[model samples]
Target: MSVLSEYYAALERLKANKPIILPKGSAINNDTVAMEAGRKRGSIKKSRHAALIEAIEQAAQATGQNVPSPAQRIEQAKTKTKAVKSDYEQLKEDYEKLLEKVNSLLLENFELKQKRI
Candidate 1:
């Protein structure tokens, strides 16, 4: 794998492990403070990984490596965002449909009992 890919993978691994945060307005020893700082730095590193990967990919493209076009990159990001939105919408629709079905079943049972009486 490329250097950028390796770095991105490492960041992903780090993100999988929760970062420690110091409680607000809490007193901490020097050791604890340093540890908190390290965790914060790691969080920043993880957040920047995507941007760094994009930059590296761009650089590779400039150097005639196999990299996606600028249009392709934009499209890929948009596609990902659209997919997430679509999934959310589908979930919402399914929930509504289930709720409607339950309500209809309840009404039907209620009506059937009144007719029998």
Candidate 2:
């Protein structure tokens, strides 16, 4: 099998907890994936096997054994920031409306007091 295909197979096996080369229940990581594919530890370099690395990372994330990829995390942060900005805008609008109402009430109270005096 091609080297890339071997890595893919190893990734699947690792995800399934049935690594052929490594001991059973080995955690899915770049090193373990490489070793399971009959490669040296640290063989899965991003410069050479970016797709394989992405696949392994996604698998690890799916299994809840690793955090989301950097791209995924950035997208999540952007979404959360957008929501927070929207909420802040809405709150500012509400605050401005309430301030106007309070100012109008205070003015009306002052006028009443002046007339009474």
RMSD of each: 12.8, 10.0
TM-scores of the models, in the order given: 0.37, 0.56
lDDT of each residue in 9-35, candidate 1, tens digit only: 433333333324544432222222324
Checking candidate 1 for backbone clashes, the offending pairs are none
Model 1 clashing-pair count: 0
Candidate 2 residue-wise lDDT at 41: 94
Q: Which stretches of candidate 1 lie over 4 Å from their true place?
A: 1-39, 42-76
* Top-lDDT candidate index: 2
| Candidate 2: regions farther than 4 A off | 68-117
Cα lDDT for residue 94, candidate 2: 100
Q: Provide the lDDT at 45 for model 1.
A: 40
What lDDT tens digits, residue by residue, belong to model 2 across residues 4-109?
9999999999988887789987888899998999999988999999988888888988888866668998999999999999999999999999999999999999
**Clash number for model 2?**
0
Top candidate (TM-score): 2
